[model samples]
Target: MSVLSDLKTVAVHRDFRKLFAVRLVSQCGDGMFQAGLATLFFFNPQNLATAAAVAGAFAILLLPFTLVAPFAGPLLDRWRRRQVLLGGNAIRVVLTLVLAVIMVTQGVSVAVYVLALVTLGVNRFLLAALSAGLPRVVPREQLLMANTLTPTLGAVSAVAGAGLGFLIGAISPAGVLKDGLTLTVAAVLFGCASALALRLGKDQLGPDRAATGRGRSWAEVAQDLRATAVDMADGARYLVRRRTPGMGLGVMAIHRFLYGVNFIALILISRNLLNDPADAGAGLATFGLLAGLSFAGNGLAIVLTPLAHERVRPSQWIVVCLLIGAVSQGLLAITPAFAMIVASAVLLGLSVQGAKIAVDTIVQRDTHDAFRGRAFSLYDMLYNAAFAGAAALAAAVLPDEGWSALVFAVLALVYVLLAVGYRAGIARIDDTPREVPVPQPLDEPTDLV
Candidate 1:
């Protein structure tokens, strides 16, 4: 069914509608909050001029959460999801306000970073609650459609919020005031999201006592955490046995790593190479434009991926996408001209999204339902860690301006090698018939965030 039709079908569920509203509003605020941070970290004349500084910022924001994600599921299950949605956004509203005050008064500092970290961490719980609660609101028949519609629309809302934030920041004078004002707007939206969450009943989004049993004690929670590590290891072993999905995961990680490096490079190039180092506002605007173009390319991939599947196998499609990435990076290696960079952004965006779609399908198609959650948990960890690792690599190699033809050339070569290697690996695996494991019910409900 079409996306619009799916939305229309799910709109009849009042509870789903309420939950959807919360997700859309909260994610929009998320985008606005991120935009404010980007200005403060990347486009501000006084902050983050070097690649190392940018890398440090990414490490501070992303690495900690990547490490904590596995344990989050147990904690999330303890809370009433309705309260999680409400309290989480309410917490963010306060945190964002405090962050704005700090930006406006004291300027960027350790306090600001710590607050941002906490705010974003709360956001992770809110998102997990949304996904976990989804099954409770929608009928099993419509659940798939609801899943497809909600996240897609939420992403659109986020992009709209980001564009709005960028415009608001662009109009204001550069510095703390601009960032503070933008964050203030985000805080307001977060407040709205929190208010919306109140519309849902305390027990509406639930852990369902029958399903989860009694709440665990602190000791039991600790035990659960320990078991999570074992569960993850078991999932890894399963993937190794089912070579195709494991290889696919590896390829996706490589892609994410390379893409993350280019992302940091894009920021530096936009800030120092494309615009005057002192003209922070112009740099912000240029980056916004390029980012929008990149998102446009991502949107195009949504249309193209299914078409490609009809013509070639998903594995082959991955190779094509990787080659496309190589071509995109090669453009920058040839020249860092603004126009060439713009084109590269679009192509690279397409390549990343296209490859991701193919790999996601491969993982889902090959993984057993019993191990699916763990497989994706590992996927999420690799996704964030690869990007963080790439940021570190970029810091070590990229210059202050982020214009390194040598780095671009190396990235392009790596992309080509990854493509060739993945294709050959898939060819070898295709000849061997792999046994599919019988799915078993889990002892406890698994959170599939």
Candidate 2:
């Protein structure tokens, strides 16, 4: 089916509409919140001066969530997903308000970092709920379309939110008030997301009875740390048992690790190399413009991925994207010019989003519904942890100018290695089963059991 037809068919579902609304609003808020924080941490003259600071800020904001995923996945599998969405958004609303207040009063202090960590932790939960809930909303056949729409639109919403936040900061007075007000706007968006989430029924998005009993108590759902870790290990073992998902995840994790390095590079290049060091606003604007261009790539992915899946095998397509990443990174390393950086950003965005869609589909298709939550939670954990590890490495080596040809070369080599390694790993599957089985129409069993 064409994109328009798929969208028209899916959009008519009341529950999907509500869930999509929640995603859109929540992501927009996330965009604004991130922009506010980025400005405060990386673009402000008083705050951001070194690559080490940039890496520290990334760790401070993201690493805590990696710690939270074990507990989060188990809880998601036990609790009603709709309620999780509602409560997560509500918590985000409260946390964002608190963050705004902190931005106003204290700037980017330890208190702000702690609060941001909590807010991000909540966000990870909310996203996992949305992903888990998606299969329940639409028919199995349209899963590809649904995945394309929800995440791509949600990302566009986030980029729009970031742009709006940048606009607000640009117009407002400099310093604490600007970042504070931007975060406040994000809080309002999160509030709207919380309200929208209320429209869904309690059990609308589910952990089926097989996964969790109808009357699973909140206390039981609140599994202890040890139990959560054990569950996470179980999920890991499950992925290991399924060769395709495990291999696909490795491909994605490597891409994320390299992409994480690219992320810090872009920020530093914009803040120091691409723009005048003294003019932080100019630097922020440069980075924002590049981000917008990258989102353009995201838009192309949303439109192209489903269509591409029609002709290209997911595994092969992932290898193709990785090769693209290698080429992009290699070119950027050869000459870190502003124009080259912009082009690299677009290719990187396309490469990442393309690979991500393939991996997401693989996980959802191969993992049964009972284990989907845990599977995705592990995905999230690896995704962020890779980025955090990259940032830590970048902090140690990347200079203030962000022009490290050797680092870029290393990243390019890693992408090449992952692509080649992934291709070889999947050779046996291609020769035999050829492809993982996706869920068919209701006339056919999903094999979900």
Give model 2's TM-score versus the native structure. Answer: 0.91
Query: For residues 353-449, what per-residue lDDT tens digits would candidate 2 score against the true structure?
Result: 8888888878777777766788888888888898899899989878999889998998899899889888898886661223334232112111110
Q: What lDDT score belongs to each candidate, Candidate 1 first?
A: 0.78, 0.81
Tens digit of lDDT per residue, candidate 1, span 1-449? 44456577889989989999999999999999998888778877776578998888888887887787654444444446677777778889899999999988998789999999888777766766676677678887665445445655676678789988888876888665766898899999998998998898876775543124356899986776787776667777888788877888889999999999999998888888888879987888888888888877676666666567768877898899999999999999999998999899999988987777676666656666445545665666677788889989999999989888999999999999999998899898882327757434334432221
Off by over 4 Å in 2: 1-5, 174-176, 210-223, 431-449
Residue-pair clashes per prediction, in order, are: 0, 0
Query: What is the TM-score of each predicted model, taking all chains together?
Result: 0.82, 0.91
